[model samples]
Target: MTEEDWIAHDPDPVTAAELAALDPGERAARFAKPLTFGTAGLRGPVRGGPDSMNLAIVVRATWAVSRVLTERGLGGSTVVVGRDARHGSVPFAIAAAEVFAAQGFSVITWDHPVPTPVVAFAVRHTGAAAGVQITASHNPRTDNGYKVYFDGGLQIISPTDREIEAAITTAPPADQIPRRPVHPADDTLIDAYVTRAAMVRRGDHGNPRVALTALHGVGGELAMRTLRTAGFGDVHTVASQFAPDPDFPTVAFPNPEEPGAADALLQLADEIGADIAIALDPDADRCAVGIPTPDGWRMLSGDETGWLLGDYILSTLDATDAATSVVANSVVSSTLLGKIAADYGARHVVTLTGFKWLARADAELTGFRLVYAYEEAIGHCVDPAAVRDKDGISAAVLACDLVAHSGAQGISITDALDRLALRHGVHTTAALSRRVADAVEAAAMMDRLRADPPAELAGFPVGATVDGDAVFLTGGDQQTTVRVVVRPSGTEPKVKCYTEVGLAVGADLAKIRERAAAVQQQLLATAQSW
Candidate 1:
């Protein structure tokens, strides 16, 4: 469509004016590519172009969502809608709610912003046909996203995402679509979420000091409440980042996994001599952890925290239930969790990299329950039953429980990790990313790797599995076994590589860990050249 057509069809005159003011070349770039539903949902800059996340795109996407639900015989059923504190979040959320209401479904939205997981929980709690959360999670300050959860509270996958894209392509313009005004729902949904999230704590033994930071997102208030309800009252927070701020002035990147994003939290931990630290992503769907070490304060990699939480949860389950429980992680994550699950007589599952796949892992086992799931990107599902998606808030509660249990035994999470390493070998992980000019270049890079697979990576003789999708490289050297998964990034013009190195703990565990980490660095170096 032309700029004039888009401006005429835009429901909001403000964004329409923004679109109208663009010059020809600028307009061409804005309309270069329309946003497609992928990597969970629609995410982009909240701007006024058809390609950007404006009212025109949101309205059409919601119409498609409503149509998809209605096609499945779910018309007129309740659908929960919510948003986080971000640019255009309020209007986008209200527009989505009204679209659902006009499409003949009951709409429930919040008066204030909320974490992404709360929207997932509210979906399952209220038996809503679906849920929509307007958030960007850990993305930059200028971005926003739309995530949809079905009745089970897991993000939609497969043909559903594809179908929505097709429907959006043919959907009517925003101004032509009908919408009914919808009011915010009561806050009982938030209360229910807090109560259930606090139930993830498995122990009540020791008092450990805790420090947390929300990174200027909307999770601080509820995270504190959940911790307080779980009997872990000794908590301190990074005051500057505790409140919701869309600008995210304190950190260059809002993601806790990014370097220096958790600096303030660690500094506060050192100041308070806290037993543990928690860093929640902007929307509180991912959690990164920090702990004091003999050397200094250190933040655990997502995989290390995964091992600790996996071992702790498995150790606490009833023996009877252990046999019927499952722990899961993505294909590219460290394999140590599988070893821990095996030691506990439980099963482990490796799925495509996303919570949509990890959250639904139990379906494959029929009768088994998904006890836990973690991705190397600091996403954890400590209480999948309460909320099928990755929930940093619930994961924080569980992390505190693990800290309390370790403190009662006069041990630390570091000691716990060491024990796991001694039993299952040291697992070190890192990533290699190569940015290209565009997705086409990224695809060519992946295609070249698939056509001529590497015989060895980082000096280890390697074996490759070149499926049409991603390339998985595995090999073993004298000191370590290196595993790597390479694919193109979903949101950027780059190819991403995830590498992990494993070595059996020898007489000197520290030396073995160092060797493994060195191998990881070499593996990343080799992958970078691809």
Candidate 2:
């Protein structure tokens, strides 16, 4: 079929008109390649093309999901759907529900925008066969996406993702796809999530002055309510970014990890003398934290937050039975968590990037219970048993509880970090990423790195190289450690390199960190050149 055929079948007039206005060259570019669905699901700019995220794409994707479910003997199963406040998200979500309903499946949908984790929780809470969340996560406002969760409320992996894509290829067109009214989602699920989130707190730690921001997405109201319910009544939200604005006017990008993205929240923290600050991504599935330091206020790296939370949870567990308690981080995350777990006699597991793997650490292990899991990209799964996904609201509440407890003991978050360093080695981490024109270039880069690995990084001799979808270069002798993992991002068109350096606990941490930063820069420069 040609572009005209696609436009003819499009249900949304706005997208159809946009496609009709494009020139011949532009039209070919738009339809030349079909969007590929992977572990992250379908995501791209909101445009009228097979390559973009439009009504037709969503309808077809939903139809494919329905077919896949039926083929697996779940034809009449319940499917839950939810959306963020992104452009075209509501209509796209509704379209998905309509497709599901048309396929003889029961559909449940949220009336208002909610966090992605809520939808994931609803899938498990209601025993639905599948769930879909319309969001772009921390991507730019111009982008939108579809994320799928299976029966266990975990994102689909491996054969499932591939099977859905195959079904999409043979699905009917948008106009031919059937539609039906969607049922209202159960509000009880939301209440249940809030209650479960509040329970994550260990004790009645007094409320600490906290500043929070939603980054102009849909997490504002829910986050505030959850905090207040968790005994944190002194929460202050960034006024400019509290509301769900699709354009995200306050920041160049909605991701809290981006430079200056959390400026407004930091400023608010200083103004209110907040003991801690938190920023949630657009979908509220990831969290970024900031704390007051002696010189000023600074945001904690994802690794730092992961270490703190992992340590706190492990410390509270019954050490006598640490073998049954497990903590996990990604392959690229800091190795300090392993040391902390060992100190507390708990087990530690490492997996590939993404919570889809981290959340299932327990299931993969023989007889261990996953107490906590985190990745270095500000994604934390504090209560995997309840949500089984990264939940910013729950993480924020837990962070606040930690802060309140630390304050009561006359120590700050920084003080806790110092103590951690004193016990374990000072571990530092850095990341380097490069955007490429296309996937071909990314593949070539990875292939080249694996075939001819770097002999050395900075002044350290390269110890070993392991190859996979990502390539790992290890450095240092038997005493210290340095590592760099280079790979293409699964969800975006970029190649990312992760680097880490470990120093003995007694070394001057400041100077060691500075040297590590220099080494990271050198490694990044070499990788970029390749």
TM-scores, one per candidate: 0.97, 0.96
lDDT of each: 0.90, 0.88
Give the per-residue Cα lDDT of candidate 1 at 464: 87
Model 1 lDDT per residue over 412-472, tens place:
7889988888898888888777879977899899889888988887777999896546899
Tens digits of per-residue lDDT for model 2 on 150-236? 867998887888898999888877889999988776688899989988888988868899999999988889999899899999999
Poorest lDDT segment (10 consecutive residues) of candidate 2: 505-514
Top lDDT prediction, candidate number: 1
Q: What lDDT would candidate 2 get against the real structure?
A: 0.88
Candidate 2 lDDT for residue 489: 83
Q: Model 2: what TM-score?
A: 0.96
